[model samples]
Each structure stands twice: as C-alpha cells, then as structure tokens.
Target: MTVNLLYSITGLLIFFMGICGLMFHRSLVRQTLALNIAGAGIFLFLVAQAYKSDTVPPDPVPHGLVLTGIVIGASATALMLFLIGVHQSVSKSSNDEGERGS
Candidate 1:
C-alpha cells in the first residue's frame, strides 16, 4: 500500500487503542495519557491527509491547525493534572479529619 494509506491506518489504530484505554482504565493518569494519545492520532491523520502528492505542496491549514491543537492539548493536560491533584488532596484531608474525629 501507499505511505499515506499506511499512515492513516496507523493513526486509526492508535486512536482506537487510546479509546479502549480510556474506557477500560480506572486510573485518572492513565485516562489522561490515553486522551493525549488520541489527540496525537488525530494530528497524524490530519497531517497525512494534507499532503496531495510529492510534487504539490502540502496544505498550510492543517499544519496551522495541528499547532493550535498541540497548544490546546498541553493546556488541557495541565488543567486535568491540576484537578486530579486537587481532588486527591481534598480527599486525603477529608479522610484525615474523619480519623481525628473518631
């Protein structure tokens, strides 16, 4: 098969794997990592589709979109991690308070 086709297939596989991981895993960290992987797959697919052929220049729009997506993904990941940390701390403190009260 063609290189583009191979890239598309690989991206699909990665995306599916991410979806499965997100659905099956219990850990917040694992789910976050899976979300990142899915984002990467989408990026790859977009870039691969942007190429028309070897002679023609690839579309600039997809590249720009990918850059924007990367920035958004990074920000989202940071937010998720921060939220997870806050949740853990809150739960820990609540548990400690309960123990002291007993």
Candidate 2:
C-alpha cells in the first residue's frame, strides 16, 4: 500500500523478469539487455529505500551510489554491445572466407 513497498515489489518483479530473460535467451545482445533491466530495477529499489522519513530529506548517499552505478552499467553495456558486434563480424567474415575457399 505504501509507496516504498510498491516500489520495492515492482523493482523485485522487474529484476526477476530480467533474470528470466537472461536465462531463456540465447543471444548475447538479449542477455545484455536483460542485465541492464536488472540493473535498473536495483537502482529503483535503492532509490525507493533511500527515503524513509517524510519530513527529513532523502539520503543522498544512495542516490549518489545509484548515479555511479548507472554510469558504470551504461559503460559496461556499451562495451558488451561493441564486443558482440566484433564477434558477429568476425564470425561472418570467417564463414564467408570458408564458403569462398570451398
């Protein structure tokens, strides 16, 4: 009923969905996307938990941590996508070379 409880439940659900996607999908890109989803859920949960008191201001530490996590997650996702592209290109080139040789 409370906002924090709702957010916590929603975050957990999203995180679980991501885990399921990661487990079921075969493609690296899909898995990467799932990982990002999970990270977002975690960040949301942290943000929700940061505000316990209605009168006092929300804690800045968790917000700062979430911001840092988002940056790192974005960087890691970009790196993963780039690597996946490289892998696909290399695989394609090798297949093409094989076909030509044969």
Candidate 3:
C-alpha cells in the first residue's frame, strides 16, 4: 500500500478512537480531552491529505482553514476548561460548607 493510504488508515483509526473516548468518558475533563483528541485526528488527516511528496504541496485553502480552526478550537478549549474549573470549585466549596454545618 502507498504511504498516503497508510496515513489515511491511521487517521481513520485515530478518529474512531476519539469518538469512542468521547462516548465513554463521563467527566467533563475526560470528555474535553477526548474532543481534543478527535480534533487532532482531524488536523492530522487534513495535513496528510494536503501532503504531496514530489510537488509544491496540496492546495493552500485547506491548510489555511485548518490553521484557523486550530486557533479557534484552542481558544474555545481554554474557555471551557476555565468554566469547568470554576464550576467544580464552586460546587466543592458549597458541598464542604454544607458538611461543616452538619
């Protein structure tokens, strides 16, 4: 098989793994990580598809879009993590105070 085909298979496997992770994980952090893993798979797939061994490289449009997507995903994930942290901290604090009063 060709290198490109091999890459495609690997990319597909990564994507499936991510999907399974997202489905099975219950905690917010785990789910988020799973999503990020899936995102990485997509990025890698795009990169693989755009690779041309003996040429100037595949089209620039997909690369540009992938770059933009990566930036957006990173920012969104940062915000998500912050929100999750805040939520967990607040919840734990409330639970602790309730226990102290009991």
Best by TM-score: 1
TM-score for model 3?
Answer: 0.86
Of the two candidates 1 and 2, the one with more favorable TM-score, higher being better, is: 1
For 1-102, candidate 2 gives per-residue lDDT tens digits of 899989988989999989999999999999999999999899989999888878989989999999999999999999999999999999999999999999
Residue-level lDDT tens digits of model 1 in 14-72: 98989999999999999999999999998888898888899999999999999999999
Please tell me which model should have the higher TM-score, number 2 or number 3.
Answer: 2
Candidate 2 residue 99 C-alpha distance from true site, Å = 0.7
| Structural similarity to truth (TM-score) of each candidate | 0.95, 0.94, 0.86
Mark the regions of model 3 whose C-alpha exceeds 4 Å error after superposition: none
Clashes of each: 0, 0, 0
**By descending TM-score, how would the candidates be arranged?**
1, 2, 3
Better of 1 and 3 by lDDT: 1
Residue 87 in candidate 2 has what lDDT? 98
TM-score of 1: 0.95
TM-score of 2: 0.94
Q: What is the lDDT of residue 38 in candidate 3?
A: 83
Write down the lDDT of every candidate, Cα atoms only.
0.94, 0.94, 0.85
In angstroms, give how far residue 91 of model 1 lies from its true place.
0.5
